[model samples]
Target chain A: MPAQSSPPRTDSRPGGRSARVRAAVHQAVKELLTDEAGDALTIPVIAARAGVHATTVYRRWGSVGELLADVATSRFSGDVVVPDTGSLREDLERYAYDLAKDLSDPDTLALVRAIVGTGGEGAGVCRMERQRQLEAIIEREQGRGNQVPTIERAIEALLAPLYYRAVFTDQALSPEWARTLVSHLLPR
Target chain B: MPAQSSPPRTDSRPGGRSARVRAAVHQAVKELLTDEAGDALTIPVIAARAGVHATTVYRRWGSVGELLADVATSRFSGDVVVPDTGSLREDLERYAYDLAKDLSDPDTLALVRAIVGTGGEGAGVCRMERQRQLEAIIEREQGRGNQVPTIERAIEALLAPLYYRAVFTDQALSPEWARTLVSHLLPR
Candidate 1:
């Protein structure tokens, strides 16, 4: 979990050179992952793309897998707005569809696979973000005096199937499939 | 998917030196995965342990990730005995519990994560094996004149939650949890 936290900034100044370097490195990693074969992704190649010293890149991110994990975490948390459609079913359906779409992207899928491969704090961070979003939706439903499934139940019913298909099977996820999962979770 | 098939044997003789070499290499990979840190795993190290030349290892396996994937596929398919308890509910519960217990082992979990990371044919091979087992159970239930859920539904309800918790959350899966999933799916 230590790697889940951002490393301390070498320069304490706001909007400083350290922040710039981190941003450049992350961008470089994403671009490489998208445009090149996975085998072509190495420290020197990424460093060259970012216009940073290979040692600097190596020092900042111990390995390519860790660098990919960092980028994946930022992309997962920063993007994807949680829906608030008032109805729990609608909210969940929209959320699932969005997730399915995101995972369908080759780059995003690669990032997810990389995170799974890295096998540590990265997956935990992404899971926490997902849990937080689900909790918020549940809390809102409770305030509206509507019965809703537990967050754990929601995850088991709604999220797991989508991810399982995305990662394991070649099955293409669709909006209809997303709606089906939500319906199963909250049958009318 | 090409890698999913075993490479042609250099020695066409049945139970020949090629077969022994493959066995030794697989055993060496499993022992290294169990005993050493993932970082310590390399073609040379595994070759040394297997008493095979590093070039031979590389020529056959290509990379450590692929080698790990091959071992994982063999382990996943070979070790588990699929349940056939006549009753669908009992069969599913036993299956889930066994899967949970297997994934709980650190070595097995590491192998699974490695397979996922390798991405492509390895995950497909494991999924196909699981699907085949489920199909067998469903077919047996049908033969017994009992109604059963589709393989897709079984996967969504029974397997997805187990894998999701294993890979994403730190949640410890229990026998009760496995039974609960089967209950939710069967709903008697």
Candidate 2:
């Protein structure tokens, strides 16, 4: 996730500053989701945090789903930078471990769920970004003349466990789980 | 998923019958989820369909999350019947194709989202039931002197893609995709 940018308020005349309001609202969403320690992402709660009137939020983004779609589009246009370990398996292990930690964060989980719930451009962007990153990894491995799992197998091994445990079960998404997934994929 | 049961209406006296009220509400939830083509799952909508008072629904379930937890618990206490085959790989392939068809249902998608959104006992139940079924399959395979993917790997291969696609993308869960996952697991 990216850090929130603070915009100048001097250009913030109430009647004509849609950009300022948008920034404030987006910033508040980022901040609140970063913590995940707040109340539900109700419009009133978000509007209060943004220091904007609730009506403004309602008018600009009619529903929480629309707002989440915008957030996902703005924030997750590409995959997170992948670690370049010497080997594909090591790289996958490191990526899975990092993802495990990210999935453990309440805010991260909520952000993902909201993105998925929107089922809009945000989710599409997320899927495409992941595919691009996976392709890059596979290309590098093929260049090395190494056997590699197909992208679909890699997806099942690397991404699915973290998400399935996070979304469907109360079990902790642990580094051990990450290790187990990589081991299953490579089976060395 | 279990088939819907039609309980006798004589037990529904509108007073002093918590069991009857619970059954009605559960039945209504099942019916509505089966036809996610209808409308959103809301207290008033469910209550009207169940022939129970809206206040009763609200008082019992409190929210969609709570209601969904109960529905999942009631509906998915056991795994759906798996097709039998002499070869473990063949069995898995058939099961994955069948599951692909089931997951393609709009109602199944909604039910899964609701269960995940609830993130309560229902999810726990879903996980455990699948584990039991997978274990049964593995025992049969071991008896035949055949190797099997661990339950964890099996889950990542067979179940996770259905969910990952349903929750995270607009892609159809095609039979081809199902075959790919099974082939990746037990490549010939």
Candidate 3:
């Protein structure tokens, strides 16, 4: 018989076994995305890579699309910070610049491709979460008395272009391109 | 076997055997996208649908991605027209509106996702063709002495956002949204 830790605590705290499991799964996903672009990512494969039980992984994320979205949500937050440059235009411009810079990475682009092209109910959930994050940042700017477009409008104008160049086209994602988005939106 | 026409003519005019073959293949791709959103489309399956020889299909379009891109290029031109209404703002607004309208269709969206997520090599060619078509329209506008943003900037600001909304989110595409894009760029 194999010695195993006590059954996973159902009521674990923030840094408990549950969180560790999530971190391990996320790490495995990051590694897989890095090691193999355009590879089919199954939960079983991810569990094997993470040294976690397949049942546990399956219990949390039922489909590759769900897992992919979770990975993107985690990575997107860590990579992009909401710009807080006092003025709304400057804040947006700076944020857009950073976003473009981060999204330029091949790994990030691949992650985005997964989210954007992963068509299903899981992708729907992912889009909702992602859109909320984007709106929260925009709302914060509006709260600071900076006039901004609607959240949907801002996403379409500011964020979409960066992603377009990143995944859809073979174009460079320069900071200048981000600035161009800001200039178009907030014509100084 | 049923009677077959002579070997496909290498040098056929616009409405000749070559044109007919291309049309059939494009039509088959369209039907497949509509009927089966996530079906793996092989050269043989597509050939059977188009009633064209598998070798002929393979010779012209080496891969599914290539065939899909051709379908998109053909459809993109027909569905979207360069807005030639007098004023540049009006032109862009109308063009953006039409783009959003056309992109909202399920079939068109599927074709776009196919190209965008087709990974390396294939996506590059599709993007290049799409960008060229966009440039041609913008160039025509610039030729008319409209002080528009560069072709690249127009794409970033105007085009990318539409695709982002269409494919990346569950938001509805509206003509009003297109007006917002135009206002953001060419303010009255």
Listed models, DockQ each:
0.42, 0.34, 0.38
In candidate 2, position A175 carries an lDDT of: 88
Between candidates 1 and 3, the one scoring higher on DockQ is: 1
Over 4 Å off in model 3, which ranges?
A1-60, A121-138, B1-64, B77-80, B121-134
Candidates 2 and 3 compared by TM-score, better number: 2
Q: Chain A TM-score for each candidate, in the given order?
A: 0.82, 0.73, 0.74
Shift in Å, residue B36, candidate 1: 6.1
The deviation in Å at residue B21 for candidate 2 is: 4.3
Please report, in order, the local distance difference test score of every candidate based on alpha carbons: 0.79, 0.72, 0.71
Residue A88, model 2, lDDT: 83
Worst 10 residues of 2 chain B by lDDT: B113-122
Candidate 3 C-alpha lDDT tens digits along B80-101: 4566776677777777887788
Model 1 chain A — which ten-residue stretch has the worst lDDT?
A33-42
After superposition, which runs of candidate 1 have C-alpha atoms over 4 Å from their true positions?
Answer: A1-15, A32-36, A40-51, A63-66, B1-15, B31-37, B40-51, B63-66
Model 2, position A39: C-alpha lDDT score:
35
Better of 1 and 3 by TM-score: 1
lDDT of 2 by residue, B58-95 (tens): 79887766777777666566548855687787788777
Question: RMSD to the native, candidate 1?
Answer: 8.3
Off by over 4 Å in 2: A1-9, A12-20, A23-55, A73-79, A118-121, A143-148, B1-52, B77-79, B143-146
